[model samples]
Target chain A: MEDVYMGIDVGSISTKGVIITKENKILSSEYIWTEGNPIGAVKKLVRLLEKQFDKENYRIVATGTTGSARKLVGTVLSATVVKNEITAHAVGTTTFHPDVRTILEIGGQDSKIILVENGVAVDYAMNTLCAAGTGAFLSSQSARLGIPVEDMGEIAVKSQHPTQIAARCTVFAESDLVHKIQVGHTKEDIVAGLCQAVVGNYLNNVGKGKKIQSPVVFQGGVSKNIGVVKAFENQLGCPIIVDPDGHLMGAIGAAILARRNKERRVFNFDVEDMEFITREINCGGCPNNCEIICVYRNGEMIDSWGNRCERGDVAARKAANPNAAAV
Target chain B: MDEIRMPKAEYNHHEMVVGIPRSLLYFRYGVLWERFFQELGVKTITSAPTNLKIMTNGSRRAASEMCLAMKIYMGHVESLIGKCDYILVPRILDFGLRRVMCVNFEALPDVVSNIFFESPIRVLSYNIDVSKKLDERRAMVEMAVSMGFSHGKSNKAYKKARKAQNEADSRAVKQNEAKYKNDGITLVLAGHSYILEDEYIGKPIMQYLNENGVNVVRADLVDRKAALRESERLSPTLKWELSREIVGSLVMHVHDFDGVVLLSVYPCALDSMVNDMMLRKNRITHVPILQMTLDAQTGTAGVETRLESFLDILKMRKEVEAGNGREAEA
Candidate 1:
């Protein structure tokens, strides 16, 4: 059997998992709603992917994880490499498009722009201060418009003239969206306008002051919408490339990273059967009051973090050395 | 910094408590100002650490256009209302003719006064206008006189407090310099002392950095006098006193740090401009920068991800540099 690597991206809204061979060929993949439970979501994702590829054909040698719950899920899986979404996305994109100079990723909760130089991420900016230009905004708007998010792209592409909505702030975007609806604008035009607004807001805020060189690749959950892709191309005055497996890029990147590393953690397929539990405990050691997540396998603690001071070590080390905290 | 333990000296002046809102210049001068009051036989109390309630209450009272830090400061001032005899909201004016603090700093006292116009809390007034020859020492002296301290007592108190502050600043610089000797990644958290030292605001970032196996050296840890002299080359016309030091620290110790993390509170007029300017100057350098803007809405997940990515990038670069050195030697 050939060796295979697994990568799981347990994001806030959705969880994605991908299995790939040593040659970068994706053997199996799955995407599912996280539904506020990352571990359960990832387990279901893995179970679904497990059904896609025959275990006899490839042996899962190592695993990696990324996204908002990268640390938590990485703990559950005992991943070989736990990377952030930015590095994962960069590696995933550059693996396929080595000459790609820029990557514009608008995910469910946040958006980021990665500037690549010589096939490496030189600089990047994630939407730190606001959730103005994100998939959540579009999803909420889609609900308000009584249209499925999946069909929003087709409706937007049908619009001959997109409405002009405010793209400065999320508050303004929401109000402007309602105002356009009250003014009797066509649904297609309004939907297209939203795509434009998201693009404009992202460029004005997250992409502000960024040196955006061409051969730009746009990905993430937002890339699934054709309207957003068209808007980006129109505003950038250049073509925006959208890959079919854009949403799985972070997972793909994680798998690639796992393959590059010298050491590998033997992945257990029986993670689905194992008892994994998480508890959030506040560290009272200092004023930082870091809410640490303690992960336990069966009755034993595996790992913990979230403290900023040496005082918090009593709580963090409680996982492996249970007697350290003195109960 | 809140993490650093200062002298535990206390005063028995129970008649009055001076409320110091832990925002703006408080991080830099809180210890000295508090000590000066203590020396003059006056007790001092600071507002509780920043929280959502303090932040929202402040935002509601302040103008929408005010920066996040200014708004948080107002909230802190509000927290001290009716709890103390006076609230210290220093009116720090221009440093010199061409060198100035942020316009917000210059207008902060007025802003606080207007916000609490109907309230009973008396906002302490200390005008630090070095451009007009009224330096920080003179302002402190005048403030002490208004509080009924004798000229000789005030002079002694100021000297004692000044000595403590100077020693603390020097100690900070020395400790930061020691971090340079370590063979690992070091990040200079470039921001105003207030934004960087606030337990509720800036402390978490420092904590995260510490836990992530990176040493954090505050840009303000560098001596202001020396930093100002070194900063003139970066931008001679950069008027903001703090921003000049932030930019200057890089020029002074650019090679010491593996990367620069330009941390700022969201909606800061001074920081936004300075961050861009500083990044532009260091564009050609190998050192990567992570510009993080913290606001009331900021979460730990986002910050952790960004910092992790930055560290990974730095590690990769270090490996590449090592490989290059080996090839060159061969």
Candidate 2:
């Protein structure tokens, strides 16, 4: 059987999975909302991908996971590699666009700018202390405007004139948008302005003081928005490449990484049916009171993390799996 | 302004236990303080390493706008309450005009005294403002005398403490210098000693870097006069002493390390300006820099992600430099 690889990107808002052949060709792919339950979401996501996967023709040899919930999903899938979304995105983008110099990623709760040179990422910055210019921000503002977030891109591109909305902070932006709406600005113009604000906020915050060169790839959930794409293109005077599979780049990158790994572990699709429960245990052994996350498979603790000291480590392990050996 | 009252107990000063909060200046002058007190035959009790309970209590007592380090300092002060006879709170203004510390240091004694005014807290304090002609030795000797030690004894203790501090500092600098000989990816950790050595805030990052096979060099380990002089090459107008040392160390040894990680606590005024300048003026050096601003939040997820990505970048670049770029994919 041909060797295949599986990759999963479990983010806060969405979960994406993809199965790829040895040559990095996509064999199957699936995307679903996480809905705050990463364990349940990954199980659903794997099942969806399994349905599309050609089990007889391809055998998954290695697996990888990425995004915010990468560790959680990686544990559930027994992934060979668990990597950050930045590295995943950079690797994924550079694989498709070898000369790409920059990656603009606006996820559900965070935004980042990665600068690449010679097929390697050189510099990067993530949004600090705020979630102002992200996909969640756009969707929430779209809700306030009584329009679906999916329609924002089309409506934004229709505006001849865009209103100015302060995008420094969400609180200020929301109040500014309210005032503009009351002042009788067109809905399309306001929507277009919001798109511009997202770009402005991104450039000012995440892309601050960095050199943005050509061959830029904009991925993540917000890349689907043509309005923001237009704004970025207009501001930077450079064409932004939005791959059709842009949202799955993290997953695709993960799969690519899995394919590159020397270790081999055949992935089982039946792992999706396993009952995985994530429980938060406050290890009160010390004043640190570290909240440890213990993942259990049908009440047997499989993995744990988040303890700062060895005392908490021992306490959490004992508390999480009472029947298991002390070691 | 009301005159601050010092608690007057008839007990001998040598028998009185002094509480040193493990925050801020403690990380800088802890060895000196401890050694001096020991020489004076006085007992000292240091507060425990920072924890979640101390952090929460500190947050509740601190002003909303205070930086995370200062808030943690407040928590440390609170932890020492009712535990010792007198809490040592040093007011460090500046070594010189251009070497000034953040205003928080100058205001520490007042802040601690005012915050714990009703808690029966007696503050044992010292002032060091070199521009005002009150040097460290003078300040330290005066403080010991005020604690009822003889002038001769205080002078001897201060001298011994200064000698001990110098040796400790030089040892650290030598250890840092030895890292340059290692044939691996070395990164300079540029931050204040307090933030870089704190148990809750900076220890985890250091541990992670060590576990990842990265050689860590501290920017504060270099000679003070040499670092301050080197800093003038980067920014002549740079004032903060700690910031100057970090910049000087980074500039002096930029070519020695593979990369630099500038760690700063959230909302730090000095670091905000200094780090921004460093990033903008980094055109002189061709090294990758990653800035991580930490807060009181317990989650290390975001920090871990950034660190992992940073290491990946460094490793990939190294591979490409070695002409093995094709094999380093992903």
Candidate 3:
């Protein structure tokens, strides 16, 4: 039977799943909105991917998880290889495009520029604090303009005289956009200008002080917008490569990592229908008072985190022996 | 009712005590600080000794990319929030004379205020421009005036406090000078004295080296005048006052010391750039220099291992040199 590897990218905004064959051929993939529920999103994604799997030919061997929710999803799915987003993305991208120099990734809430040299990520910069160039920022602006976010790119292409908007921050960008609209700028021009602002903001902030070389691949949610892609191409004076499966690159990367790690461990996709109860408790050990989260399974404490120190061990121990005397 | 004396005019009793975390500028302006606050009649509270809890808490509160010292400073500020009416987190722009602090120090007050917004501790600040004659004296007077102290009282207090602080610092400098006069492998540590005094960060390394029979000399322990002079020999263009002093001490005592350890906080942009330049440009053939960056996550075990290996290398080199000297004598 052909071996199948499972990869899960559990990001803040969405959870992605992919099943790939031994030869790195993507067999099945699914994207599900996290909806603030990672566990539910994973379950839904797994079910969708399982439906598309060739059950007669493929046998699941290993699993991998990446992104912000990697730890939680890894624990849930029993992933063999869990890696950070940077390593996973680098590995996944280099496997396909070995000579790729730069990887520009702009997602729902954050954006990152990874500088690759000789198939290794030498340095990288991420913009987490700013939201002006992010997908969420675009989505909100789309709503204000009474335009569907899906059609933002198409509308941007129609703009001949795009309005100039301040892209320093989300607040400044929003006010600038509003002022431009009030001054009777065409919707196409405004939308196109917004896309340009995102590209400009991203370059000025995330791409500062870095040598950005050619053969650049722009992936993640924002890569779907052709306007931004054109902006990058024009600004860098280099062609921007956008894969058809660019949105699923993170999931694809996770799958590639899983396939690489499958030699060590075997995986089964039959997720146990176990209910997990998560609770948040405040740890008042110091003035900082970090609020810790404890996860319980079947009336027993399984895992706990959020407290910055071992002071939260008391909460964990208390959860373990509820009938015992309190500390 | 007929003899009700006019109630004393309700004096604005808005007395606020500002707490300054004694980690960064505390060593630099110990005298100036005491005098400035004393002149204004404002109570000052400093955080307790640096401990593991403070370090951990500070790291958690700070952004992932902040330097190690700033994180510790945050923890110190967090400790002082409820204990004091206001935290005297002064935003220093420039010291004039082309001397400037790290960008992190300039943004510290703003960052701290934003980070701990839930806490009701007020921040006090003063802008210093020596070029405009707005010196430390003017800064203290301005701070005092803002705090409702009369200009005359603030000036008097500033003078007295400045005198007291200078006297105390000179004594410390003298003590350190005496300590360095001993016959031993004097390792001159060129870094902030607070970093050396910090329990979780610098104190451990100092204690470990001392226990291993190595005499530790602090670059910050030297006289300011002598250090400045020494620094001129090392780098004529070294603009940072603190870094100049450290480099100056290293140049003067490089031959006297067995090895030099240039300690820096993690993610420190200015220090990393300057220290890297110093390590590359200086050709001190006799002494080996170790560049170590301390962060919140830095474990003592890792530090101990590095120190042990460096010491071993130095010992082996010394032994080989001694053997050659004996052979030459024969």
Ranking by TM-score: 2, 1, 3
lDDT of 1 by residue, B1-330 (tens): 111111223212467788999788887887798889889888788898876567778888889888788888888998898788678777788878657888888787777878898998767777888866888888888777666667889888999999998888788889876777777778888888888877767888888788888877888778677888888888888888888887888888888878888899878888888887776676556467888988765347777788888877666556555554211210
TM-score of each: 0.84, 0.96, 0.62
CA shift at B144, candidate 2, in angstroms?
Answer: 2.4
lDDT against the true structure, each candidate: 0.82, 0.88, 0.73
Error of 3 at A49 (Å): 1.4
Q: What is the interface RMSD of candidate 1, in Å?
A: 5.5
Candidate DockQ scores, in order: 0.26, 0.59, 0.02
Looking at model 1, give its docking quality level.
acceptable
Q: What is the C-alpha RMSD of each candidate to the true structure, in Å?
A: 5.8, 2.0, 12.5
* DockQ top scorer: 2
Candidate 2 displacement at residue A3 in angstroms: 0.7
- Measured by TM-score, the strongest candidate is 2
lDDT score of model 3?
Answer: 0.73
State the displacement of the C-alpha of residue B48, model 3, in Å, after optimal TM-score superposition: 3.3
lDDT of 3 by residue, A75-192 (tens): 7776877766655676678667889989998888768787666665544656633456888889889998999988999999999987898888778888888989998999999999
Candidate achieving higher lDDT, 2 or 3:
2
lDDT of 2 by residue, B1-330 (tens): 013425333447656888998988888789999999999998999999887888889989999899999898889888888888788888889998798989999988899888888886777788888977989999888787766778999999999998999898888889888887798888889999999999888999999999999988888888888889999999999999989988988878878988889899988999999988888787557578888899889999989998999898888877777877655433
lDDT of 3 by residue, B261-324 (tens): 7788877786776776675564445245666777765334345534654554344345444453
Please state the error at residue A191 of candidate 1 in Å. Answer: 2.3
| Ten contiguous residues with the weakest lDDT in model 2 chain A | A318-327
